[model samples]
Target chain A: MVWNEKAECMSREEKEKLQIKLLKEAIEKAYNNVPFYKKRFDEAGVGPEDLQSLEDIEKFPFTTKADLRETYPFGMFAVPEDEIVEIHSTSGTTGKPTVSGYTKKDLDIWAEVTARAIDMAGGTKKDRIQNCYGYGLFTGGLGIHHGGYKLGATVIPISAGNTKRQIEIMKDFQSTILTCTPSYALYLAESIEKEGISIEELGLKSGIFGAEMWTEEMRDELENRLGITAVNIYGLTELMGPGVANECMVKKGLHIADDHFYPEIIDSKTKETLPEGEKGELVLTTLTREGMPVIRFRTKDITSLNYDKCDCGRTTVRMSRITGRTDDMLKVRGVIVFPSQIERAILKIEGLTPNYQIIVTRPEYLDEIEVQVEATPSLFSDEMKEMEAIERKIANKIHKEIGLRVNVSLVESESLPRSEGKAVRVIDKRNFD
Target chain B: MKIQQISVFIENKEGRLKKAIDVLSKAGINIRALSIADTSKFGILRLIVSDNKKAKEALESNKFVVKENDVLVVEIPDHPDGLNTILGYLDDDKINVEYIYAFVSNKTDEAIVVMKLENIEEGMKALKEHNAKILTLEDIKNL
Candidate 1:
């Protein structure tokens, strides 16, 4: 079901006109109020007036995550501090977190997009939402909370953790919708099974899982185990959290809220815009953001966009599931490998847990990768040869997938660390410097 | 008779074997017989201990990957070709011996051979038909 027919189902021409109008205003606002954008525009020899059409966005320089880090806290905010009512930041696990501030109108837009997202997941005012996203400086928690409130759904702001309590409350409250990272959803499913509660006892009808990259195999697993329709929610703190785009019940692709956030796909190497259905890096421009108006913000996420109207009847452009991040790609022995590829290989093997860690090391100037996977009870046997054969089989499968021979080590069950947030899947010890 | 054997995964690094044994020794668990099958990268340290469950818990608590496997322990006379006699029975029956490790018992004039076979049940039956003394869990622990 489309959430806002006027906004989500507008004609392409009408949407483009709205986007171009807002895009010009956003650029002018950033150019006039933010020194960083002004200097960037000055250096590029382009001004806000240069944007005659939406295509003129290509003339602007790309704003990168590093640029966001350079600005640090509040440097990217276009509005005065007094007008900014809410602030959220990235986890900054790699470095400094990028801060995003929102005026009252910006918060309403956030809620509007998120409400659309929740509605696309089949959530309504009668539905109870158990939001498991963390609630601190991270935008995920509050992003969904605001959306659920805006949708007038019964919002259970349980935050995250305490798995036992989450399960208990989910049962007692009969929450109809669940929201959290996909990894945490799997963890919750495992916990629910261990707790010996039948999935039918819980009244969950759908899940809004996002915040990290997950595979289709994982989605199927969650759906089968939890007995709910699992859909992907795409968002970034720089744009707006948890609601920039969402997969409708059609589940074809995530529909971007075009009127609020303009989406573009650009070639990663060439920095040239690619046509729809062509895979490239995603660059976003917040068309209507008042507090932190970002222009051509280069989101390192890689995916293709489809402008064809979705079967769900939403005219907003849809982006394919994020395949990989440009920065997360690993070069092993001169061949590019992604953690998702390795994960897909591991999941294909029966009796193997989805939990795995890829370790890349440089021993004697040759790059070697070791995939450590947790062994389930069925896979663990006393016969050393049987175990060795299983390890060899895993190594061969991974070799077939990534074209690199890797050592497969079978670790004990539950030995690997589990994360409530994004799961760390790779450890590269090769120092290129 | 099937003997419970504890196998621990040890990275092929210096003092790793020592560290694994230390965990068991500190737990007051006695090792009856032990063998290590290793490659260049890592090794599997297999042990027949006084108590398989306790040894497994101790090693696992100390962060070792421990697995319990069933192996056949047979007593052979402490003489020339004693092991060969037991192997001949299995070879005649077409049972493949995956691996075998032996230890001489101080309490008896017999050496004990721990054998892992491709078809463990068939190998055990062949050994029994040939009148080979298969050691029970209690027999190995007492020895």
Candidate 2:
């Protein structure tokens, strides 16, 4: 199932050599073409010539999301506007969306990397890919679409929503591969059941789900519900789309296409590179991007990198699944808690549905966290004392996980908002100002 | 005989009790006797209503967590030693009383005590052996 075995299974020495060469060229291109990189390089007093080896990238100034916002639309593009063949921008919910421009060559590299991702997920030319990542401005849809095409698979560009239609097409077309965000995939699975379609009737063999942070418990739920091998894909709109890295059939971790985009783990606070196997913010460098060659782009995603060769026979370094974003981590009552921790704790309890909402409110002078979880049919009881005990158990588990005693509220089933895309899990009502 | 008591979970907040009462009143459900067991976070408002089913439906429709359980309604003299005499009978039989709340009956010189016990049958047997007057659901409704 290894795609482009030569590229993926290259010897460590050979891959590092290629990475060093690409890194040098990308740095030179960024400094000479893009004014932003040139100014940054000048400020850091480190030029492209200083990058002698792959490790030398540490001297470069790290590019951040804020830096991308400052540039706005096309400040990061290294090539002329005429050569740019495609553009993708983030949702920009936080502020202005950071735009990523790609030349025709850049698009080809994107397709190649995504094709490798598809291959890693056990996809082949005969497989039908039902891509549900959303088309238009979002890179997820088109990214997987082009990658499926490159792999010579029959790509169904259904592009997100219309749950009934998605189920119908999936059954009729006998799609062998499914691609979308993990949350949306779960939602689609729920819809498929609601539509009275048996999971066995569908021809899905595997799925490539990513774009939002998810937990291992979520993976188990998706796999059990859909009867497919659920694998995690890692990518960002700021980098390339969904093709940056993907988990193979081995499913140990996502295998990064380090040949194209170099991966690094850095201490988010210190802005220093962390050694392999240490969890920190993931920073990426587009080693071969022609249109927008970025140097040391801080992704802000928290994860660790594993250089150990995967059992799938790929020598390319793999990254552990993202745990949380530094920006999204919540601080409650002076205790730092990630929404993923709450999710993990809730999922550990039997008979509770995965759907939940964490509300952090300042009632008076103290901060309180209230976790409203949906009560599944199995969890709901006729006895009030039994229900109260379940609530107390959930509170105790969450308290053990986050070191903060939170109020657990058992809400009606499906009462919480399900995401068509990313599930909004946390609502912080405390005004920091 | 066991009497039906409806317990509504009310959060410890302003006007929550009023809101629960409002729902019952709007539904034409009459409250017979009520007691609240509270903690710092929330309260369980235990009630003896004229119509258990109607009161439960009303509170539940308003999104309240309501539970129905059996409690023994025993008739005790309105004098100071009435409750102590009943407790002494139950204690001698080793029957545990989880909770007890009472209201004076206007029709007689006796007070009606609602007793939630660890074992309702055992507690009732002990009370009957001691010649205690246990009121049925019909008796509480008429009162």
* Tens-place lDDT digits, model 1, residues B1-143: 98778888776668878998998899999888889887675677888998788888887666677788778999997789998899999999999988889998889989889998889899999999999999987787678
**Least accurate stretch of 10 residues (summed lDDT) in model 2 chain A?**
A375-384
C-alpha-based local distance difference test score of model 1:
0.89
lDDT of 2 by residue, B59-81 (tens): 76666767788999999977789
Docking class of 2: incorrect
lDDT against true structure, model 2: 0.88
Number of clashing residue pairs in every model?
0, 0
Worst 10 residues of 1 chain B by lDDT: B60-69
TM-scores, all candidates, are 0.89, 0.80
lDDT of 2 by residue, A375-410 (tens): 654564434566688889999999999999999987
